[model samples]
Target: MDAIERDDDDIEFVETAYANVAEFVEQLLLPTYRRNPAKHRWDPRWWEYQEVAMRLEALWRSFEYLRLEGPTGMAVFFRDYLDPTMRELTSENGPFWRLDKLGDERGVPDAWPSESPPRNMF
Candidate 1:
């Protein structure tokens, strides 16, 4: 059997940059990020889509980690994480695609179809 080593530093709790994902998106992300309406799609009611909310939360967590990495932290965060994630999130085929087409009055669109795989496939 193999054993994994645990370090005290790993267990240390670090405070997050923002109180919640919404705070991060409203205060830092949305304010700083500029998107061309013609190319990227964004819905103000982002939380309605589970996938978008999850992705935003992930981005918020990533930002919290990267912000502590010194001067180059923000640049790397933008280049490595924010750019790609935002591109995908706002892409024509992304979670918000239907919202863009159907208009905000229609509400959230149905989730993409999926089927459960055989147990223990992993």
Candidate 2:
């Protein structure tokens, strides 16, 4: 079943993408969460991360929440997944509609903030 295969591929792709997005969100939201594992238990996103990671719809909503929090760099996560229909959906005042249009909260560098990681670790 080619369609089944495609769905499997999508599932795997989304899972990995979700992990990257989640980690980036964590880094942005709280650079020190990793240092304090107990903080994760208090972070709503961290508490629900696993369940949402396994469900596409929930994952997308979580991503939208990230966008609202700070939309910068999110276009990368959905890059390959965007399709004509998906693009149309995002165009209609949707959470993702302005993803490309929204600037970073700081409206500064197109890159991650200095406090953001890959440089600084918790």
Candidate 3:
């Protein structure tokens, strides 16, 4: 049926979006963990990062947990797909949210600090 096909496509789209978001979070957060093993694993910041990423992705597909303040459907994209606090920092050019900015605890860049990959056998 046409309805069944449409529903299936919608489900597929949601699954793909979630997968991409999860991959993005893993890539972004793993470096943080490596740079500050003691602090990140123990501190609430790590959980915050995970929570924000997960929630954002969920909202992107479902628009379930967001408050919007813009043109029709515009806020959904920003609210669901973006990190609210990080966006505040990066979108406004704030020092706390730059790729080159260092983390206060680890001295690693906010995104990726090192120019060379870690030397490993793997």
Candidate 4:
């Protein structure tokens, strides 16, 4: 069908926009955004962290979708995805929390202690 063909074309366009996650981050993201080191944390080894990797992938997909929408596309992406994601990602307690400002890994903190709720409590 024509709709299916169009969908396939759109997918191809998005997939080819960036060669990989690293390319997106290194080429487009890092250069454009500036972070205050005093308030935020970052590690060059961001891909090593599972949460960071997943978030970056989601951001990349969102970017690919929004970029087709013309002028307001990036505004929406920044408001909806980039701002919140970068805030959480670079927060002190974010996935990079294990690393110090110099990117040295402080000892890992123990996982948060938790227990299952009573049956049917939900």
Error of 3 at 51 (Å): 4.0
Error of 2 at 43 (Å): 10
lDDT tens digits, residue span 23-61, model 2: 544544345223322211222333333432343344444
lDDT of 4: 0.78
TM-score of 3: 0.27
Model 3 regions more than 4 Å off:
1-20, 26-50, 59-76, 79-85, 88-101, 106-122
**3 or 4, greater by TM-score:** 4
Once superposed on the true structure, which residue ranges of model 2 sit more than 4 Å away at CA?
Answer: 1-19, 32-52, 55-62, 65-122
Instruction: Provide TM-scores for the models.
Output: 0.80, 0.18, 0.27, 0.74
In order, candidate lDDTs are 0.81, 0.35, 0.37, 0.78
lDDT of 2: 0.35
Per-residue CA lDDT of model 3 for 1-122, tens digit only, reads: 01112343462212232245445345543343243322222222432444445553554334322222236444654554544544432332433232333344422234546676678935
Top lDDT prediction, candidate number: 1
Q: Extract clashing residue pairs from model 4.
A: none
Off by more than 4 A, model 4: 1-15, 106-122
Residue 118 C-alpha lDDT in model 3: 72
Error of 1 at 113 (Å): 3.4
